[model samples]
Target: MTQQTKGKASALFPLLIFILLFIGTGVLTKDFSNMPLNVAVIIAAAVAIFMNRKVKLAKKIEIFTKGAGHENIMLMCIIFVLAGAFSEVAKGMGAVDATVNLGLSLLPANLLMVGLFLIGCFISITMGTSMGTVVALTPIGIGIADQTDIPMALAMATVIGGAMFGDNLSMISDTTIASARTQNTSMSDKFKTNFFIVLPGALITALILWFITSGSHINQLEDYSYNLVKVIPYLAVLIVAILGVNVVIVLIGGIILAGAIGIIDGSYTGTTLLQAASQGVLNMEDIAIVALFIGGIIGIIQYNGGIDYLLHVVSNKIKSKKGAEFGIAGLVSVADISTANNTISIIMTGPLAKDIASKYNVDPRKSASILDIFAACWQGIVPYGGQMLAVAGLASISPISIMPYSFYPVLLGICGITAILFGFPRRKVKQ
Candidate 1:
């Protein structure tokens, strides 16, 4: 019994060590970006190895290898690679510029802020990535702010909100993929469950944005030239994904189509597409590495009884389906807060959430939805998180300034709680 207790305590320690090293070092340096997350994860992984003295070094290494290469982790890594390639190729072929122009052109001057939010939402949904959406739109958002009476913080907040919205719901999104995989549900099922929960919140956010920015006007309406042909790739990806194509197939098709269009449009010649695709894959290195380390560390933690301990403690408090849902939500939120990465948080909490869901009979789809929503919420509002920092950097403003204006994440959190309290979506349990 003492041996089992020791194993559980040792298993839980690595996560705490990782948190302190990652967040603590960032706090000390006054720059979270300066500390590579991969390094901190590696450190924690090493500590995890050291703590398990009972296991031979070779066996410990074998266990870490198995976790790192687990089927789900490997699948996520493949999607990351493909998604990265698609995003870079699409950007290289001018898809982002065309999409942004097309989106902005459709809205009147009075609803420019709303247009920014919608454009962000559309871009993220199509691209299947929040970071990419923010990177592509924050500059435009800042440009609009500079040319108009709108405040910078508010403008940045709009982009962040829309980014989170798409991130929470996009079928191709890493969070969506991780959530669905972790919960052992299909992405479409999770999306269906998630959509109803957050749709009203999104609509309400748009309404509020329209009201708030109603009085603001652009100094000069900048005319943008959009090539409709360049917009086809994004539309193709979104349509295909919505049709429930295998995610890998969806991304592969996007890459090939984008490359063909770029070649025909004179946007690429010879190896340009190849080079762009390679660069895109390289961009995903950090995330891919972090995923491997997290998987391995989590494996070790589980082997040492860490996950069982967590399940025991959490399951003890779960009295009903609502409590189980809340536990899943709370677990991912705290993990995302600590890691400052929603995808990582989802991966870390996925297995444990499954256990809780199984024990309390929470619907897998709802559990997945709750995981994605809460992770997105915490990620959007946390000043230190990547989403906020990315927008803040682009707008040349403090992340703290972007916090109050993050309406979508805030509203989504409120709605998520309401859903749990009222048992929204009302799914039937599997017999």
Candidate 2:
């Protein structure tokens, strides 16, 4: 027990070092874009290795490598690569334009803001990736802003909020998969809990958008021909994913489908298709590197006792089930803030959340929901996070500029905290 406690306490140092290095440099520079997260993570990994006095240097290196190569970490890397590939290929084939035009054709002028949000939600849910949704829809949202009276930041925020909605609830979402798998819960069970918890928030966001953007005039898609065939890949991915297909398979299928459609449509030849796919994978380099470094760092910390120490410190004040649930929410929120990736945060905190839930008899389903929701909430709003960064790049606006308009995450955070404080969705009893 003494040894275990020591390990946990020791693990925290590396994590703290990472946070300080990453967040500190960003704050000091006043430019998050200048501070590379991957570098911070690598330095933290080095600190983790140096702090491990029990093992030889070679052994420590092996441990670090093992952690980075863990099955879960590798799976996430694969997903990122495939998701990037699929998104890029689809973009190359003008799928984003097609989707944007299709959505424009269906909505009334006054409801453009709300329509953008809803479409983002649908695309994110269908794509099972918030970044992908942002990549695909941010341009469309910007176009809407240019065409209508809506502000650029407001339009982009709508896309972000909607993307987060799907990221929070989509079955194939990385956060969902991480949460359910880590908590030993079923996706459907967690979805039932998560869906209802966020439904009110989603509805409120839509209503607010409608009221705010009511005066905006809609712009017709003049001479914009949308090919419906271009949308089949997203639809296929969503359909098979909903039917319980493996996420990797779903993404791979989507990539192939999009590539085939692109080729047949004369959008690209075989060589250009490969180039697009390769570029897509390259786009994910930062995240992929961070994931690997984090895996290695976390592995060493776990080996030395970081997670156990964290669990001890986090749970020390919890007495009731509600407190335990709240602790879980706080755990993932902090993790999300530190990492700036909702899916990665979920993966990191999930095991500890499960432990807390089991000890306090908190429902696993609720735990999973809380994990995904809070992570998504924090990730959606963090200016440095991938979602916000991607949108910022596409919209040519500061990520923080979109914060006030990020109604979904704000509402999500409110609803989530309220649920924990008030103990909504009372724990179910096993028959």
Candidate 3:
């Protein structure tokens, strides 16, 4: 038991230091961005390597390289690229305006809150990215908030909560792919477990959002009559994504569809199309660069056996099914906090998670679902999370202020934990 405690502390030391530096700096300056999150994550990762006394520096570098270059990160990067290109190309061609207008027209003033929440969920689910979902939807959410006189925090949080729902649950989502692949569970099975757990939380949150915004009223406006042809691309993207088409192909097809429409409508010149694509890709520059660094750093950690050290220590602590579930949660949470990437956390902790599941006879699907869902619940509420950062940038608000409004993530975690305690998603035990 002492050894188990020691392992947890040793594993957590880097994270403790990171929070001290990262959050400490921000609190002292009252500026979250004062200490760059990327730089801080790198520094913390180095410290993590140093803690591994058993591993050599050169070997550590190799592990970090392997983890960073893991096939999963590459796949997420591909999604990021496609999302960037599509959003850019579509925006350049006035698709956003037309789409937003069409949505506004369909959603009555009384249902604005519900409308925004649903839209946020739909877009994130389709986009497989919470940040991209936010960027695409926020300006419009904000406009509606202002025009409707709804509380900004509540409105912003509504969208954020919905976005996280998809980020955590979407089959093509990076977090889902990471956790499922990591735990050696079937993606379809994980989805079943995940959906069952999160469905109630989403329903409850939606009702709450509805209640919260029910008192507010807005003047209804006429729906913008845009060409039905212009709506085809976005609509098609949605339909194909929901049908389980490959995400990369979905994005590429969406881009092509949008571009063709743009050229046909004279909304985009050939030069504009190329320029928008370039510019759109450029928007993801920070994460793209940071992802490369993070991959390399984790590769070193892996090479040094730091990750194996965690596996040894954490796996030893499991004495029961409940303990195993908590351990899975702990593993992913630590990796998520360390990596500052929920999907990466799932990837990093996957092997260990699988081992723990096997030892405890805990359901693999449940294990994977728990890891992804909890990581997202934490990630969504974190001030430093990418979703918060992007939303804060677009909404011009502090992350602290937005935290209270993220009702969906908060409730999702609550309900998810409850699900575990009650064995809520009791699957037929696979003999």
Candidate 4:
């Protein structure tokens, strides 16, 4: 028989300390970038290890290693590395510029904000990373704001809203991967459940942007050049992923296709292709390390009964399935708000959310959807979040300036909550 861990609120102190150290440094320094997330997690892991005197040191080390080396966690880290490599290889081959130009060239000048939003959505979905999308589109948005009557904050907010939309839905996104894996569901299954819930919000946000920018027009529009061939890899990745192919295979294929095209088009030499791939893998190092640390810390916490304590408290308050869903949403939202990174938030809250879902007989797909949606919602709007901060810095504006105009995240939060209450897109419970 398996051992049953007792609930212990004191076990959560280490997690609390990590949060305080992370958020505290950011708050005091007035710059979140000053304190690296991995550093914060390392301290938290140490605290978790040293606590609980009753457990032997040897057993604690075993628990930590087991969690760090868990199949799901290891798989997640590998995906992050592969995703980074594919993204870098694609960008090095001029895929990003080509995709951006192609989208902008086709958009109407009069509908600039709407165009930006739509293009941001498309690029972010294909890129599978919002940070990259925001970086690529913010300059374009700034130029539009300067040339036209659009407010800089509004233009930047449009980019942010669209990026968040894709970040929440993309098949290759770290947030989506973490949520789906932690909930024990497939990415395609989670995407389907997530898409329907957020579609209404996206449509509404697009319409709002259209109405706001309908009267605006650029004084002089530049004709952007693009290569259609460079765009094929992104499309293939998206399509293949949706068709339920293995994620690792899809990413590997994308890298090969992108690298081949880059080499043929003279965008990359044989040696440069290897360099780009290595750079991409290096770019993902921080997140991969953070994931390992978080896994170890969470493993320690679980061993010390922190997760059971949380489950006990949450279970006492949750009466129905809908309440249980809300509990899951709230848990992830708080984590995102605290961490300011949607992917990390999902990872931190996922194990607990899975426990809640199983106890309430909630669908794993739906639980995964809730985790991604809520995490993205808060991450998009929070001024401290990387998306908002990056866009704000690029546009030379305050992060707070972008929040009011970030309509998608607000609408998404509403839609997510409504989906929980009314159970829209209802699926028959599996027997």
Each candidate structure's count of clashing pairs: 0, 4, 12, 0
Strongest candidate by TM-score: 3
In model 3, where is the ten-residue run with the lowest total lDDT?
1-10
By TM-score rank, best first, the candidates go 3, 2, 1, 4
TM-score of each: 0.67, 0.74, 0.75, 0.66
lDDT tens per residue, model 3, 5-121: 222345556556667776888789988667776677678778866767776877766666676676756665565566667777887787766665666667665688787788778
Error of 3 at 127 (Å): 8.6
In model 2, what are the clashing residue pairs, if there are any?
A: 7-304, 7-305, 8-305, 11-306
Every candidate's lDDT = 0.79, 0.78, 0.73, 0.79
Residue pairs with backbone atoms closer than 3 Å in model 4 (clashes):
none
Which regions of candidate 4 are displaced past 4 Å? 1-6, 108-200, 208-221, 318-410, 418-431
Candidates sorted by lDDT, best first: 4, 1, 2, 3
lDDT of 3 at 11: 50
| lDDT against true structure, model 1 | 0.79
Q: Name the lDDT value of residue 224 in candidate 3.
A: 57
User: How high a TM-score does candidate 4 get?
Assistant: 0.66
For lDDT, the strongest prediction is 4
